[model samples]
Target: MKQFVFLIDTGNETSEHKIHATGMTDALKRVQDLKNHLNDNSNSDLKIKFKGIIYENAF
Candidate 1:
């Protein structure tokens, strides 16, 4: 496993998610999970998007 940094662009704000996964697909799934959590917990009308994979194998 490796550390992957996913750049999540929420239209109004940007956040970084550092996840441990074996590949890009796994990292992407993590991002989606985060998005779901945010949507379920907030009413801020977030426009969530997967910006890009910023870094891989960070540590």
Candidate 2:
């Protein structure tokens, strides 16, 4: 299985501008796409999953 992890920082001074522009929903969608991309080529025959989301000090 492919595990996707997204660490979002609302106030990450050094964060990329795209993060703020795309927001979480769109980002997670990209993650789903990534999982699908990996699943298509992997030989493990496992399911794709999103672990836990840890949020702190969300702006």
Candidate 3:
């Protein structure tokens, strides 16, 4: 398995989330699900931005 890191930026603060998957395709699906989940549960005044995904060991 591989590790995928996602940066969530909400103007004032930034947060990191890690997802473990078999490949990029699976990782991306999980990321999208995360975005949808956040959007669904967040307040109308709050905005969520996804900076990008970092692949572990890609460097």
Candidate 1 regions exceeding 4 Å error are: 45-59
lDDT per residue, candidate 1, 6-51, as tens digits?
6666567778777777788887787679878988977776554444
Worst 10 residues of 1 by lDDT: 48-57
lDDT of each: 0.70, 0.43, 0.70
- Candidate 3 residue-wise lDDT, 1-59, digit = tens: 57777777655667788888887799779978887887687753334444455556776
User: Where's the lowest-lDDT run of ten residues in candidate 3?
Assistant: 43-52
Off by over 4 Å in 3: 43-59
Q: How close is candidate 1 to the true structure, as a TM-score?
A: 0.60
TM value for model 2? 0.40
- Model 2 root-mean-square deviation: 11.6
lDDT of 2 by residue, 1-59 (tens): 22224432223221222222134576567755655675576544434333344344455
With a 3 Å backbone cut-off (N, CA, C), the pairs that clash in candidate 1 are none
Question: Which stretches in model 2 have alpha-carbon errors above 4 Å?
Answer: 1-21, 45-59
